[model samples]
Target: MRDTSTSEIENLIALMAKLPGLGPRSARRAVLHLIRKRALLLTPLADSITEVAATARECLNCGNIGTNDICPICEDNERANGELCVVEDVSDLWAMERAGVFKGRYHVLGGTLSALDAVGPDDLRIPRLLDRVPAEAVTEVILALNATIDGQTTAHYIADQLSGQVRLTSLAQGVPIGGELDYLDEGTISAALRARKEI
Candidate 1:
C-alpha cells in the first residue's frame, strides 16, 4: 500500500519537474529543500505563485506580462524615450529590465516568426508594434532579439517594415551563437545594448 502523504510529495516533485531546466533529480532535491524550509521558502513561494496565477495578465499594448491591462512600464511616462526595444517574449523583456541599462520602452513580440512552424507577422505582436512606432513618437527600434536564425529572420522582417519609419539597430557581438536573451547575464546584456550596431 502507498502512503498518501508520500504520494502527495511525489506529485509535487512531478509538477516541479515540468518547469524549464528542472529535471527529476533537481525536482526531487528542490521538493526536499522546500519541505525542509517550508516557512522560509515553500509557504511564501506557494502564496506568491497563487497570487501571480490569479492576477498575471498581458499588457494590451506591448504584450508584456503584468498584473494589469497596461503594465507599469507602459504606464510610466518617463519611459517614453522615443526608443522602443523589441524582444521575443516577456522573459527577454524581464531580462532587459534586470540589466537596468536602457531607460526606453519595450515591445514584447511574444515569439519569433517561424516559417517551418507556419508562424507569421499576424501570429505575433508585429502589427501592434508598427502602430506604436508613430503613435508613441518612436525615433528608434532596438532589435534586442536572440541570436538564433528565427530571431534574426523576425528582426529583419520588422526592420523592413519600419525602414523609413525609424532608425533600426540590433545587439552587437558578445552574444553567443544560438543563445537566447533570457539566459544571458546582466553585464552581457548591458554590453550588447551599449554596443548595438545598426541593422
Candidate 2:
C-alpha cells in the first residue's frame, strides 16, 4: 500500500472506494469533503453508518431490509390487501414503494434465476413465497421482476408453481427491456404497476 500522512483517513477512503458506483478518485474526493465538513457531515455520517451496520437486517417474512425481523409493510395490517408483488431485489421493492401505486405487500426474491450463476428457485425465496401465499390469504401474485432473460425465466417458474392458486400478473410495457426497476422513475413505475397485465 502507498504511504499516507493520515493512515486512518487513507483507510477510510480505500474502504469507500469499494462501494458501488464509487471509484478511488471519488472516494478520495468524498474523504476530503467529509474532512472539511467533519462536524456537520462526517460525524453524523459515521454514526448513521454504525447504527445501520448494527441494526440492518432482512425481514424474515418478505426479505425487505429493516431493523426488525419483519418489515414495516409486512407488519402493517392495512397492507394485507390479498395481493403480493414479487420483485428480484430489495431495490426494486423500494422503487415500487416510491411509486406508491400498489397498496399491497411485497416479496423480494434476492436475485433472478440464472443458469450461468447456478441460481435456482430453491436458491431464492420461492418456497417461502409459496408458503406465504396461503398463509397470507393472497388472491393475486404480481411478477414485477425485471425484463431480463433470467427475470422472465424466474417469473415463468413461479407462475408454473402457483398456477391455479392465484391470479398472476406482470408490469406493463413501460419497463423497457433489460431495464432494472431501481433505475426507473416513480411515474414510470407507477404507470407500469397501474397497467399491469395478466401473465
Candidate 3:
C-alpha cells in the first residue's frame, strides 16, 4: 500500500501554497512547523478555520464579510447617517473603518467598470447602489474608489446618475494617483476623507 503520511503532508503543503503571499517553499516550512506543533498550534488553528468556514458569510446589504448574512455594521441602526461611502471593494471599506473617520454606511461595488476587462455597471452592483440611495434616505455619497482609470470612470458614471438627487463627493488629491485605498495607511485615509471635495 502507498504511504499515507507523506501523501497527507504533500496535500497540506499544496493547500497552504494556495494562500496569498505563500508559495511552495513557505508552505513547506509552515506545514513542517505546524506538524511540529500539532497540539499547541495545528489543532487550534484547524478548529478555528473550521468554525470560521462554517459561519462566515457576506452581508446582503453592504457586501461585508462576517459570520452572518448581514454584517454587524450593516445591522447597526446607529450607522445610518444619511451618508453612504461608495468603495470598490470590501478591503477598502475595512481600511476606512480602520481609519475610523467615516461614521456613515458603505456600499461595496465589488469592482470598477473596466472597458479592457469588459466589466460593466450591471456587473458591479451599480443598480443595487442606485436602489439603496433612495431606500436608505442617503443624502450624500462619498466616492472612495481607487484612483485607477476604471475607478474614476465608475465614479463619474455614478455621479452622473445620482446628480441633483443627492450630494456627490470624492476623495481629494491627497490620495496619490492610482493608489488603492487598501494600500494606504490609516492616517492617510483619514486625511483623504477629511479633505474630500465635490466631484
Candidate 4:
C-alpha cells in the first residue's frame, strides 16, 4: 500500500471510511471504483459533493436540509394540508419522503432529548416546533420518533407540551409487511396487535 501521508487517493479513502456505514475495506473498494470510472462517476461525484458543500443549508421553517433557506417542500403551497409530521432527523424525513405516501409538511427535531447524553428540549428544536404549529396552521402533529427509550421519552414530552393546542398523534408501530410473526419481538407483536384496524 502506498504511504497514506503521500497518497491523495489514500487520503480520500480515509475520509470516506469515516462516513457512517462505511469501513476501511469498503472505502478502499469505493475509492478504487471511483478512480477507475473517473469520467463517468468520480469527476461528477466530486463536483456534486463540492456544490452541496458550498450551497447546502438547513430550511429555516422545518429544519429540512436544502440549498435554499426554505426547502422546496416548504415553498409548495399545495402541501399546506394542516398536517405536520415531526421526525428526529433529516434522514427520517427523507425516508418518509421515499415512501411517497405523505402529502403534508414536516418538522425535524434534529435529535431526541436524552438524559444519558444530557440533551434537553433546548438542545433540540422543540421550541421551534411549537412556534411552527401556529405559524403553519398545523391541525395535527404526528410524532414519528424511533421506537427507542429516548425517542419515546421525547414523544411523551412533546405530547404534553402540545396536548390541548392541536390534535396530537403518533406513527403506528407494527410488524413489517413481509416480517414473520414468529421472528417478531414481543414489543413489536404487542404493538401490531394494538394497532390492528378493521378490515
Candidate 5:
C-alpha cells in the first residue's frame, strides 16, 4: 500500500476488504488474482457490477432485491396459494427458493425485533405483512425467521398480532440431518425431542 502499490489498486483492495468474509489479506490476494485474470474475470465482473448497480432495486412488496419495483416471486400470481411464508431477510427467502420447496408467496420482515438494537415492529415490514394477510386472503402463515433470541421474539410478536386471524405455524427447529448427538448442543437436542414426530 506504499511505493509498490498504486492508489487505485489499494482502493480496490480496501473496497474488497469491506465485503463480508474478506479481510485485508484475503482482499489483497483476490485483487492480485483479479489483476492477473483481468480479461477473464475482472472486466466481466466490473461490467456485471455496473449493470447491477444501475438496475438493482428492492421489491416494494416483499423487500427482495431485484431489478424491478416488484420482484418476480411477488409478481407471480400462481404463487398465491393461500399460504404465506414470513422470513427475516431477502437472503432467507433466496435460501428457501434454493431448496426448491415452499410454493407459496413470501413476505420478508427485513429484520427481527430487537430490544438491544431498539428495532421495533414498525421499523421492519411488519405492518406491510399485516396488510398482505387480509388483502391476499391468506389462510395460513409460516414463520421462517432464524432461531436467534431476537428472531424468536419477533416471531412471537407477529404470532400475537395475527392470533385468531389465520392458522399460524413456525419452522421446526432441532438437530440437523447427519448430525451426531455428541456434537449437538443441549438446546438443539431439547428442540429435536420436542418436535419429534411419529414414524
Candidate 6:
C-alpha cells in the first residue's frame, strides 16, 4: 500500500512523538484525534502552543519557566519565609507547589550533578543558590532532590557548600504511603527502615 499521510501531517506526528512519554503510535493516534476535533482542540492547542513559545522564559531568580523575568512564586513576598527548598528541576518545584505544604521560596538547580555526564556545580544553578542563601536570609534549606545517585550526590555537594551557614535537610526516602512491602525492592525497604519515625 502506498503511503497516504501528507508530509505536513507526518511532520506533526514526528514532532509530537519527540515529546516525553509519547511514541510514534501514540502520536499518530493523538494526531488523528486532533484532526477529528480540529475546531475544538487542534486550533486552540496550536494557538496556545504558539503563544507559550513566544512568551515563555526562564525565571531569572529560580530558573522556573514563566512569561516574566521572575516567576509568581519568586515575586510573592509572603513566600519569603527564610526557608528555601532546593530542587533539581522546575518540574520538581512545581510538584512541591502542587502539594501546597511548603510556603517557602524555591531554588531550581536545573539538573543534578552527574560525573558520567560531566555536569558539575558550575553547570547547574549552585552558585545562584549559594548567593540566594545569604541575600534572602535563608534559615533552612530543604534538599528535595530525587533518590537517584546523581541527585543524592548533588544534594551532598550543596549541603557541604552550605554547611555552617544554615540548617540543612533532605526529603526522606522510603516505600510510598500505600506501597506494599512485598512488592518493594530491597533498597526501598532498607531506606524505609532507616527513615522510620516515632509513631
**Candidate 5 residues 1-199, lDDT tens each?**
3756688899999999999999999999999999999999999999999999999998998899999999998899999899999999999999999998899999999999999999999999999999999999999999999989999999999999999999999988888889999999999999899989999
Indicate whether candidate 3 or candidate 4 has the larger lDDT: 4
- List pairs with backbone clashes in candidate 3: none
Q: Candidate 1: lDDT over CA atoms?
A: 0.94
C-alpha lDDT of residue 132 in model 5? 92
**Deviation (Å) of 12 in candidate 5:** 0.7
Root-mean-square deviation of each candidate, in angstroms?
Answer: 6.1, 6.0, 5.7, 2.0, 1.9, 2.3
CA deviation > 4 Å runs, candidate 2: 1-5, 175-199
Cα lDDT, model 3, residue 64: 80
- What's the TM for model 3? 0.85
- Those runs of model 5 whose alpha carbons end farther than 4 Å from true positions after fitting are 1-5
Question: How well is each residue in 72-126 modelled by candidate 1, as lDDT tens digits?
Answer: 9999999999999999999999999998999999999999999999999999999
TM-score of each: 0.83, 0.86, 0.85, 0.94, 0.95, 0.93
What Cα-based lDDT does every candidate model obtain? 0.94, 0.94, 0.91, 0.94, 0.94, 0.94
Off by over 4 Å in 3: 1-3, 175-199
Rank all candidate structures by their TM-score, best first, as comma-separated numbers.
5, 4, 6, 2, 3, 1
Candidate 2 lDDT tens digits, 47-105? 99999999999999999999999999999999999999999999999999998899999
Top TM-score: which candidate number? 5
Model 4 C-alpha lDDT per residue in residues 1-199, reported as the tens digit of each score: 5575568988898999999999999999999999999999999999999999999999999999999999999999999899999999999999999999999999999999998899999999999999989988999999999999999999999999999999998987899989999999999999999989999
TM-score of 1: 0.83
The local distance difference test score of model 4 is 0.94
Candidate 6, 1-199: lDDT as tens digits = 2366488899999999999999999999999999999999999999999999999999999999999999998999999999999999988998998999999999999999998999989999999999999999999999999988999999999999999999999987888889999999999999899988999
Residues 148-199 of candidate 3 have per-residue lDDT tens digits of 7789899999999999999999977577789999998887789788888899
